[model samples]
Target: MHKPLLTTDFLDRARRHYADEEAVLAVDGTRYTYAELGERADRFSAALQARGIEKGDRVAVLDPNTHYHLEAAYGAMQVGAVHTPLNYRLTPDDFSYMLSDAGVDAIYADAEYAANVEAIRDEVPTETFLTNDADAVEGDWESFDAALDDADPDAYERPEMDEDEVITINYTSGTTGDPKGVCRTHRAETLHAYLISIHQEITDDDVYLWTLPMFHVNGWGHIYAITGAGARHVCTRGVDVAETFDRIRGEDISYFCAAPTVLNMLGDHHAEHGGATTGDNDVRVATAGAAPPEATIRTVEEEFGWELKHVYGATETGPLITTSDAKRHFDEGADDRFAVKKTQGIGYLGTEVRVVDEDGEDVAADGETIGEIVVRGNQVMDRYWNKPEATEEAFSERLEGYYHMGDLAVVDEDGFVSIQDRKKDIIISGGENISSIELEDTLFEHDVVSDVAVIPAPDERWGETPKAFVVPESGDPDDAGATPEELKAFVRDRVADYKTPGEVEFVAELPTTATGKIQKYELREREWDEEDRMVGEG
Candidate 1:
């Protein structure tokens, strides 16, 4: 007989089968078994119900990666409430907008970030506020710890669940305008978590490190996936080089996921500290957001001896659809393996990833033809929360049933996909198309360039020309040595003359989202603020 697939099954299975297993190593150095964690989640759920949080209510949780974040999600979903996680990096105004937009009825915030919510408490529509540390916030609010401590775990009844019902309303990282909530069904999240386990080789033997934030797509759905697999989760408040290295050695961490920037930091730290000190521990890293350069991949594999796997997706597509695991037949040597790791490999097992032209025809696998990436799978989000127009646009009729990724990519003969640039970040100059990612990758090869963002600047001759905002590797970022002419020569020698940036503006850093994705839209807005059209007319 078949049964419904609810997220609670993950927690229930763990509590029943892996009750004695260590489930969470909290950021504060506390450990809890699966049974204990399940009980805590149950108590939190009971407490929410006691506070009048009925089924279908929208509850928001704001915190960094912590045990509290995990519990909040599990607890909120347990009682049939839709969980909405707030990005801690955002401002109070952003929080106010999101709380109001999602119609969040209740909030559970970590003590450290309670102040952010407190700042706009009066303006927000939420009636209930629970802080992890009640003393940390001003005014009256429920204490998360106290509520759970006082509640009975077995006192409440779980509502009958429909697997296809929306359980989470994850908001997009609003780089341009207000963020939109992507309503995800319980079925989608469960399937995504299962796919993560299958692709990442997650097993009970694996120990996971919390380098990725739990708020970002529920830590890319690792919270449930890791628990379902009975793996140990080492929670961390933040990413610290020293602490991360310590956990790798101390906790025997075998797996983690991070953006390329974090991986680069780890690589730099290892090199500075006389190379990786993990001894014989076999650590594997999954990186995304931006593809690491070929050199970075080589150093990560050769110097650190840790396997690097690259995966790609967005918040709408289960946030995971492609993985770049090195295949034995395709990899003949270290160099070949590094090259393979740089490309965002084929679709995951049950995912359908396609690159199509404007006409909705599949592009040739020549690796040169650029097309938009579209996805259709079990994990793809059903729709945006209360935004039918946007949902229709996202799942455009041009592709019939697939969701448009808004990312332009090229697929190789072997079906490996490499991203060119976001649809809006592409530069058009004098009837020529230029990929900003291509320029950024080339600039990354320069010894003195640290970070760079390429945008289209208004030009009388070329309609629009490429302009670079650069962060140098040494001295003052505004130093004249990071000269426009010098950087122009650097690009001219490597790529076509048209691809060379016309001007270089040095800055301390590029504007980025909390996830370390460069906000090219901000730069483009500034450059074309005065133009009749913000984006290139071409």
Candidate 2:
């Protein structure tokens, strides 16, 4: 029998199986049961419908990870409305573009970002602005909680969800031009959640911490999987290393995912206190976007006493097509062990992965030949919203049938995938293709660089060259703490001389997008304004 894929159905199942079970734990230590979550979601859905939001309407949600965010998401999903989750850290301009492009009819924002919505609210297609309570700021918007206060608690009976009908329209972290909306359906989200659980080994016994924002690929598909498994959810509004550690101990958090920035913070916290004792910490950390450096991975395993699983995918790909936790045949301490942990492993069930040369021919899986990565599956997104040309560009211009990942990679004989570099981020210096990831990894080895981003610079003679934007660890910004020349020499000592940055720019901190990803495209624009192509898209 075919099981339902819509999230409301999963909520119904969860209510039946774990009605009194705790579904969400707030930061202040309040708990909401699965049954309560469903009722609250029903009230919110009724309130939304009262405001004229109906099936197929687009409702944009912008907030930190919280209990209400989950309720709003489930309510939106239940009504068959397209849920558009925005990065709460985005600028007014970023929000404006996404809202106008997605044709958002309503928006639910937290108080901290109410001004952001106000700045562009007139231009957006939305009038139903629902702001949640935070430190109060005056706005003419509806109170998020108060709206549900008077609404009927009775559950809504909307049209049944079609697996093929669009359920979400997630915007990518745009480093270059406007962000593209990746439209996904019920089948894709539900199927990908199952894949994430099996690959990450999540079950009912696990207690998940929401460190990753729910807006990103629906919390990377864990929202569905964890709910299905009847797991407990601990909600957090922000990431603080000490608070994270305390929660892991106090709440007994078993699984979570965050960017390497968050992981580094936790490692620093551990170093300040006594490091994690063996088998004392019972948490699993999964990271993605790009494979973090090997040292960061080893630190979590050795110091935090946690197993770090690395994977890679983009917003357009449903973000679970590749992972690195597949069972291995080799011994534990072998040199290849580090290599295997670094490579993005085989595809999830029902997904196909391949690497091909520029000519569209499959490359040998010898772990040496670098080529573009491609995938196609049921979990793949349906298409870009209102964008036929962009959708066409995504699936073609490289391969005939596969969705071109645009990331350059290679596969080993055992079917493990290693990212050589991004084809777009490569530096063409003196006619050499220098991998920016290689240079960034080597620079990270430097003791002075706290955080670093590598992009390309325009060269009159060479056409393009690598440029490093570095953030040093030393506290004072006026000390001339770490010079660009020093960083170049640091890289020169390790990698080939040609791979070194032609020039390094020192900054107090590296700029990151709302999602905690280093905004390489903004840095790329500063260095490559005169050139036709960016070293990385800024």
Tell me, by TM-score, which candidate is best.
1
lDDT (C-alpha) at residue 286 in model 1: 90
Would you list the C-alpha lDDT of every candidate in the order shown? 0.82, 0.77
1-538: candidate 1 lDDT, tens digit per residue: 9678788888888888899999999987899999999999999999999989978999999988888888988999999999899777666776888999888999998888888789898998899999887886897889989999999999877999999999998887532344679889999999999999999989988889999888778888998899998888999987887789889888888999877667667767887886344634598889876566666677767777778889988888889999888475365454667666777789998999999999999999999998999999999998988889888988985588899988788999888888765675656554334667777888989888888888888765455678988888864676645578888999887766777999988888888999999988788778767753443421
- C-alpha positional error of residue 534 in candidate 1 after TM-score superposition, expressed in Å: 19
Clashes of each: 0, 2
TM-score of 2: 0.80
- Candidate 2: list runs displaced more than 4 Å: 1-4, 275-281, 333-335, 425-538
TM-score of every candidate? 0.81, 0.80
Report the poorest 10 consecutive residues by lDDT, candidate 1.
529-538
